[model samples]
Target: MTIGAGGGSRSNSRSSRTNKYSTSKLRNSQHGSGAAGGGSALGGQPLNGPSMGPGKGDIKHRFEIIRKLGSGTYGKVSLAYDHKNEREVAVKLIKKSAIENKQDLVRIRREIRIMSALKHPNIIQIFEVFENRDKIILVMEYASGGELYDYVSTYGSLPEPEARRIFRQITSAVLYCHK
Candidate 1:
């Protein structure tokens, strides 16, 4: 991800404020066959490999889809149970057709690569990625803690200490990414 430079200075002060977080480049990497690697890819565990995880036809067989968490133009996210590990996971389903152009596809692939490479506790963990003819499935760590929006809406505002703690964690994750 390449950060873009902001526009030139404008006569008006109001137009001077530019978005600092603008991505200019999106790079894609080839993920061979969407197959899981045997060793470290499985989180250092010795298992049946990626085959043990859910695939196209046997997705429901391996993982019990609890319910739909949310949906967007890409696809829907569902809460699923990993029958093999007996753990809940969030499955992000992205339709192949939803990606209109090569750029969009590259962006998605780049996102997958970034998620797979990052290993920070504060960030969501992506366990495995599955792709078939029609959809791409991202098996991710289930976040039991409710959404921040919901929490803030319900509680109005967080206490100073708690807010600081959360801010610290967010900054730490951002620092790790920068590193």
Candidate 2:
């Protein structure tokens, strides 16, 4: 999830170009701090365009929280089950209060906009974004194998073949972003 958005063993920046999603009500909202909490605005259009999570419920209704996957400065990720998809997903939850200012919020939303536009196989896919009064939740493709750095750290270096495979995946994602 966020590992691709500057949260992993290797950090990289996405392009500066504007994405169509940036103009959506969710991204352009004057105050989506979600500080008070409750219900999702879901922007002007419904999330995922009709086929989406509920518009008036806690994120748990659609994604059952499994366990904590990881945590970063801005948010925490939990492994969750997508009831609708009948599969696992990584739920990234960011509290609007955790954000210091509007600038940081803009950067966060920009990353979301960029990530939403991506469809590369090697990259994580963002399925839906749920915004309540205080929290912004993102349901993303689950990487059951976990973070590459965690594997390398626990196993003390990957075998050549495994390392190569991981390298290829990283390079493919990087190249996709470059394009």
Candidate 3:
């Protein structure tokens, strides 16, 4: 449900307020944008990574769109060159409407805030948050290695010891969080 120009209220639950990005909203927005003739701005262009936020025409920023990485219900990802930094970054542009409710927006904002607080090798890093009139752009470090689930799923189940080792590694991350 796309909200009006003004954003909605905030949520209270931790899960509801944390990691609120959902596949459902991603799907809906993807469909709607497709209907509106907002095809990807990428195509044959070379992409450094995924970008988030407005399209090439819509955004007034000087970011040169290298290629489109992908998109979900909330927004599309593009590979862009940051003219100022002279570096590549993945930009995620999330529309306000992709949010299910006010709580969802709050959760996403919280996640961005948390990302700004951390610096670790094991954690995904968010570099900056750029806000235009209605949308939020999340510039993040691109992980090109793909997801661990994909590797696990493609290779089949791992041996018990290997799984345990991975679990231990995750446990170490949890411990770091606690610290």
Candidate 4:
């Protein structure tokens, strides 16, 4: 989906306060601790919808990798097309070998849970998670809008109004997470 440059004003600020309490309650119910939590933050529900078993083949069998988007110590992110959905997506490929211990694995799983739980318009959607013998592939929503830093570098400083608009979107997203 294309994220535009404006339209983030909220008329009822107090509604967020009410939503905070309800959201927390819903989260608590949906994400119980330990094995009871099931496979996902949504209380046993699969995060990526249906199961796609760990098969012995290339991830490219499912997604057509378009290009490398970015990289890090853990893994690389690539722009890809989902064959099943016929849409663009970002795939994060994390090597299984890079996970040092059980704790590290747990942390990665937690990150998946958190990302999958997020449903805000500003937040990227986690479409699917696939694990092979070597890597963990996360298929996520593709944001065509480049990084904020890159945007700033290309355009120089934004006007005050434009900056505020972006800032508001960022703050609203952060507030949603806080809730």
Candidate 5:
């Protein structure tokens, strides 16, 4: 998957309306509200299709984990191939234990809700979110651009033109989100 539109053109007014509805739908979804409490994400089952068994079985059945992409405070992201979609996707693996409390869960859910709703060239498209007994799995559009910190660290500094190009892309994405 690429960092591109989810493929449609909507008036700004209508787009915001749909985005609001979509976020609400995601936040209130009972099936996805497991993980944090004593329940399972996807209810310990595969959400998008048939389950392989239990635990990591659902993930194994659906996506082929290719390699590690990166890691954050909660989990690591991996490049995986979605068997159902026939495409590569980035899988964000966040352990249920990693969520410190209800607030963290809320923040995560908010991020997921927003991500699932956004359709932009610079934002990765979230495909599906699920969980095993131990971890929450987020499937998303695969973009292989390395982290900005890593790029800067390796090269020290970018040429003025290169810096401007990166800056423009970042601002445009942020502005899109703001709108």
Candidate 6:
């Protein structure tokens, strides 16, 4: 998907909201989370609907899930605390099916490689990659502030000077990448 205005407005809107449909309705619906089927396009079991929180799942062993941050075709993301480090991290759980095919595997590996190599202030850090029977969890730096899109959306277009500052930062980051 093309990254729009920085925060993935369209895709995130559908994935982030918890009130799209009631929990029971989501569980019962065809695209519901509990449907006994192959799985969702992104690899999540199903829309299991709005959850109070992550249940007692196997993930607890590795990271303590703080809250559900977002979800996508791939899987859900949670603000989790790394028990080992005593710090918060964003865990992206991509289902096996999402990266099961050979092509996807290659892409995933390439993305991981690129992320591992990059070190810039503007970029998020990838801490680790964890795999399980049905999922791939990406441990990433947790950025406390909401995405840039939220700022623009809330305040309308940014002031010219403010936009210029952001542009300079992005340019510097690109230059660093070229180095």
lDDT of 4 at 50: 28
55-98 per-residue lDDT for model 1 (tens digits):
23345345555566677898877765665555666777777788
- Cα lDDT of model 2 by residue, 63-144, tens digit: 4555677788877887655555556667777877899999998888778878888887677778777665566777777765
Kindly state the number of residue pairs that clash in model 4.
0
TM-score of 4: 0.67
Q: Measured by C-alpha RMSD in angstroms, how accurate is candidate 6?
A: 10.4
Which residue segments of model 5 deviate by more than 4 Å? Answer: 1-58
Model 1 TM = 0.67
Worst 10 residues of 6 by lDDT: 8-17
What TM-score fits each model? 0.67, 0.69, 0.57, 0.67, 0.66, 0.62
Model 4 lDDT tens row, 45-133: 23343234434223434455556777777677776655555566677777767888889887887888788778887677787776545
Q: Is 3 or 4 the stronger prediction by TM-score?
A: 4
**lDDT digits (tens) for residues 80-176 of candidate 6:** 5555455666777777676547788667656876776676666666766644456656767776554666666788987898777667666766787
Error of 5 at 179 (Å): 0.8
Candidate-wise lDDT, in order: 0.55, 0.59, 0.50, 0.57, 0.57, 0.52
lDDT, residue 165, candidate 3: 58
Off by over 4 Å in 3: 1-62, 159-169
The deviation in Å at residue 20 for candidate 2 is: 39
Identify the candidate with maximal TM-score: 2
Clash count in backbone of candidate 2: 3
Number of the top candidate by lDDT?
Answer: 2
Cα error of candidate 3 at position 35, Å: 19
Candidate 1 vs candidate 5, lDDT winner: 5
Task: Superpose all Cα atoms of candidate 4 onto the true structure and report the RMSD in Å to 1 decimal.
Answer: 14.2
